[model samples]
Target: MMKSILFFLIFSVSAALSAQTLTLTEQQINQHLTTQLGRDFPINLGSWLKAGVRLADIQVALGRQEADKARVSGRAVVILEQGGVRRDWDISGDFSARPRFNSEEGALYLDEFELLGYRLNNQDASGQANFIMPLLLQSLAEYLAQNPVYRLDEQDPLQRQLKESVLGLSISPGQLTLQGLE
Candidate 1:
């Protein structure tokens, strides 16, 4: 019994000392997501806007978007206003990006923007969502071209260390795993 206890103690201590893994809970991940994606997407329609579309206040607000396999998915609302009139469009899609060569940041983009519905002149615009979606996506793409969001911590040693040593980051439904990170 004494020998067994000693062996267990040693094993526990050794295991604790050698451990170099960082695990984040779902709540923590959700909080980070909320904070990161909650920011308003400030964008300019550029040439996509017609003459009356000039000075368009185009903004997209993203809700909690889950990140998995280096890809993010979630819901978003696009708002456009001009001449005391406004339009609100809702969409759920995935945001993807490819990391630059040896760069910490990636060029983020909206891979799929599926408009769920919209409101035009304060009326249900669900019927027109299908038709307007293409235009909205076109303008959205233009804005995204200028502004791309990234989730990278180049200056953060912990994150950088994990990313450098880890083989890959796999995000699942409610868990994130770092493969062979340490």
Candidate 2:
């Protein structure tokens, strides 16, 4: 019985050491975001002064910059109706945000988003974009904050074991690493 107990303790220590860190590639994160966030496309940005906006064609890029942030780029379609005249405009831009993990949910989310840059396809739409971009940014931030970019698979034993023990998340070029305090 003592021999069996010693063997079991050794095995447990080895398993714990092996599971100390979990790493995910950038591609994995991007694919997860695309699959999860795609369903909510063409989100309307309520009308203001007879002008309306919609967001679609969202794309995510992880570890694109040296900073520890994920980059998201997408197109915003703007519609302006004036005196029964309708026009459509396109504004495209990319933004970056720091990633955070929620231990209770076993999920990854974005925080502290910063708009990198934006441009209107039609110069005439500059005024509209100026008025609408802030709203678009806020909407995107709120949506992403609530929705996870990636969720841990509780069915997987290693992931399940690591979920609650994860002490912090780190982003390097092209990769994300989760490590436990121990």
Best model per TM-score: 2
- The candidate that wins on lDDT is 2
lDDT of 1 by residue, 37-135 (tens): 544554454544321122122323333244432333455566755455566755654434221112234222333444343334334756646665556
Q: In model 2, what lDDT does residue 124 have?
A: 74
- For residues 1-182, what per-residue lDDT tens digits would candidate 2 score against the true structure? 99999999998888677657888886787777666532433435544335445655666666767468888777767666656877777778778888899999999888888888877777676565687667666666677778887899999877888889897788777788888734
Q: Where does candidate 1 clash, by residue pair?
A: 166-181
Superposed Cα RMSD, model 1: 9.7
Question: Where in model 2 is the C-alpha error above 4 Å?
Answer: 1-19, 36-38, 41-56, 76-89, 122-126
lDDT of 2 at 176: 86
TM-scores for all predictions: 0.44, 0.71
**lDDT of each candidate versus the true structure:** 0.45, 0.73
